[model samples]
Target: MLEEEYQPRRQLPVHLRPPVQPEPVFEFTIRDATLADMPYVREIYNHYVANTVVTFDEDAMTLKEWRTKFSWVSKLNMPFLVAVSPTSTVLGFAYVSPWKQKAAYRRTVEDSIYLGPAATGKGLGKALMKELLARSKAAGIKEVLAVIVDKGAEGSIRLHESFGFVEVGRLGKVGFKFNRWLGTVLLQKHLK
Candidate 1:
């Protein structure tokens, strides 16, 4: 390995890389989300909205928007939770929303998990997801779905699949953002 022949390694995009560590032993508490967590939650999600294709939303969400969502999820009694650090900072958040408004879809929900930029790649995602699934099942959710971005979100797809979520369908090029077309990968898990 001569220095002259050395080439810098090309790294995969951040969102595409899998966590290198095994089952994260990090310290974080998963608890119910409160109105006080809205600002942090908004900041975490809006980062993806503004800079990444992980989320189809191009505009950064307002705190008001997050508050409304929090209210709605609370009303549904669906497990809306957050990961808090020992210092009480919100490391991340996860929640489920009704998959559809129809009566027949009442037992089905879509799960969403997002972590702060500084909190990523540390296994917070896996912890959040494990708790979210347990809570979802206890909440009487028969079906859980993950609608993930087709590109720039491979890690999320892999995380869900690791938890028994399977690729049920895909919608190609349904969203246009950042001057490019994007698609969605739909993953589903059925609870016993």
Candidate 2:
């Protein structure tokens, strides 16, 4: 009689084994931001400023500048949201601000989304952006603009497109960063 072929069972190394206890899914809460959230907000923003082309600013913002920004947004009664975990750790933030300083631009606001390094790819940015847009609509914002860097930001471009923002313009070589010139893509979603 032919003996059945024996198959060896593969064993995973201890470190490669799946965790016996699964980590609990992180819980997130989205809410209107207050003065107390300024530090966390600034930290998240500065993370992008220091590490990415999400903004063209070469220098990180000081706490005083962040505070001034918060004050300005508050005075405008614009929408600002913070995503927090159950323990109140800020994961990300989104807000709407005047697109331009001119009075004619009052109804047009630029939207900004910033996430902590660890908070990306978990849908937190999308959630925050949705809430921000809802609040902007309720506040009578006519146009929502997204000014995005054109270099390797396909994810951001896709996200805005998914939210009904259409590419309205592209400015070439408008930004200098990372030892090279970069372009800017402007997307707009009409709210009114």
Candidate 3:
């Protein structure tokens, strides 16, 4: 009997597998929102109201309420921006609204930003805020204020600080959520 020569199967080295690279963070083009964007806008807002401390409101606004809200912002001539991809998916939104009901406060607007859970931490919030501030200044807004729930949201505070926002006030135990009272910190960036 002749013994057959044993052969080993060829194997590629471990390093030969293409080195895995991190996914590139998504980029957004900020633009004026249209009626068609209401659904997406609602989705983003509701996401925060449901899952985060970014917003104090516990109840999500209905579509009709959202429409009215956007309409009011438009009437103020304030910028309402929807951060969208090339495919037109709204990842997040930002806007300025009347800081107070008094006419003397007309020049000051409160700023709000909401991002889908997946959209956070990729600089979408900062981009949206930067564009919103530009539009606010163009429209003669004097001050931009952010009321933040201060549960150590360092990322958000840092983002605002990077844009010249300074802490102006803090109200302790003003917000109730998740079976606890949360403090509210006011951050303002003056454009004028």
Q: List, residue by residue over 1-192, the lDDT tens digit for candidate 3.
A: 335665667877988977779987687898999878999999888887888777888999889998998999999899999988888899889889999999999999999888887888888988888899999999999889988888946688888899999999999999888788999889999896
* Candidate 1 per-residue lDDT over residues 1-192, each given as its tens digit: 999999999999999999787864668899999999999999999988998998888788999999999999999889999999988999999999999999999999999999998888998999999999999999999999999989899999999999999999999999999999999999999988
Model 2 misplaced regions, further than 4 Å:
1-9, 12-23
Q: In model 1, what are the clashing residue pairs, if there are any?
A: none
lDDT of 2: 0.89
How do all the candidates rank in terms of TM-score, highest first?
Answer: 3, 2, 1
C-alpha lDDT values of all predictions:
0.93, 0.89, 0.88
In angstroms, give how far residue 71 of model 2 lies from its true place. 0.8
For candidate 3, the TM-score is: 0.89
Model 1 spans with C-alpha error above 4 angstroms: 1-25
Model 3: lDDT equals: 0.88
